[model samples]
Target: MTTVPPFQRALEAHGDAVWRYLRGMVGAGAADDCFQETFLAALRAYPRLHRESNLRAWLLTIAHRKAIDHLRRRRRDALEPLGEEIEAKPQGDGAIWSAVATLPPRQRAAVLLRYGGDLAHREIAAAIGCSEEAARRSLHEGLKRLRETL
Candidate 1:
């Protein structure tokens, strides 16, 4: 059997979180494709990884960028309309998935990372390629928008 590299191990370990993050970014249908692309990109760039510390954050960062690129490539002018079944379920604040779909990309990502993947501000910053303060601001702004919508 081939020995798994540390990076590979880390990728396997955190795959679910990365998938969840992508799902929130692109929705459930595209999540797996984005996840595969994220890991493939990671493998191509694996030689450059300098440290094991915060591997989850590192993987998430790659996943975030890949998700963004995937979205860009699709050239979607607006958020996809939510299906009726998904739209009917009430979110925590009695909002629906359609409301969540209306957020801007950055705020949506922050909200997804915070609530969907349960990442801290620091980790979210690493993933979103922003400062911790910025991550916090994004999350706060997202929540505020969600509150207003609901």
Candidate 2:
């Protein structure tokens, strides 16, 4: 049987990536709460998980759902810039992220999982809960929109 890492170890290893994904998904404003909710949900389900493979993808899947739920609660189809009061971002990144925030939900999640989370297309598909072809399409559509907007 495959050995699963302790839950804390998985958290330590993947926390930053998950947080960044959440930040990119829901924006910095709600990332912390989303992050907490993601991990809490993951922790609850971890013991039932059968394999250690693709733990990052599994965590990201939870994060994606949490982000979607958060967005739904706010009653928005697209994310919006939280303005200058938000946390510091790298130079010239604001415009791109602003454009990213305007993408449709699946497109945005696919883009963030691929680029922001640095996950492969297969993993992104798993995270976004779609077929690989769908994830690729979403990524393609999202990048196309960003290019057109920026």
Candidate 3:
């Protein structure tokens, strides 16, 4: 067995990162609810989880699905600007991140998983339920678009 951390410890370890990921996806206004939903769902399903599971990736996978569901329910943009409204300036932080919001859904998820979730390509593939090549393509194209927008 890979000796995953207990759920409480996993929450303590991953809570902040998961919240930030949610915030990056849905904006801070709804992030708290989404965060709770993620954990609630995770807790309900935790017992049946495989012992060899990658907990953080699994949690993030749940977060990704929850975010997508949240987006579909609300029909909102996948990502909001990071801090404040970004004027269309090339060098602004908000502008850069805001660009991320403009990507198509798959690309946006790929970008957020790579940068926001700090996940590797393989992990991102696993989390997003895509093949590694598709994940790589999304990440690559997403970054290219962000750069162009910035």
- C-alpha TM-score for every candidate: 0.75, 0.84, 0.80
Model 2 agreement with the true structure over 1-150: per-residue lDDT tens digits: 575778999999899889878877777778899999999999999888877468888888899999989989766645544433133555457777667777888998998888777899989888777899999999999999989998
Off by over 4 Å in 1: 1-8, 76-97
Q: What is the lDDT of residue 127 in candidate 1?
A: 82
Q: Using lDDT as the measure, which candidate wins? A: 2
Q: Could you tell me the TM-score of candidate 2?
A: 0.84
Residue pairs clashing, model 1: none
Ranking by TM-score: 2, 3, 1
How would you encode candidate 3's per-residue C-alpha lDDT over 5-29 as one tens digit per residue? Answer: 5789879988877886776676666
Whichever of 1 and 2 has more TM-score, that candidate is 2
lDDT of 1 by residue, 64-148 (tens): 8987887786556544553332355455532435566677888888998887677889899888888999999999998899889
The whole-model C-alpha lDDT of candidate 2 against the native structure comes to 0.83
Question: What lDDT score belongs to each candidate, Candidate 1 first?
Answer: 0.75, 0.83, 0.79
Residue pairs with backbone overlap in model 2: none
> Which stretches in model 3 have alpha-carbon errors above 4 Å?
1-4, 76-92
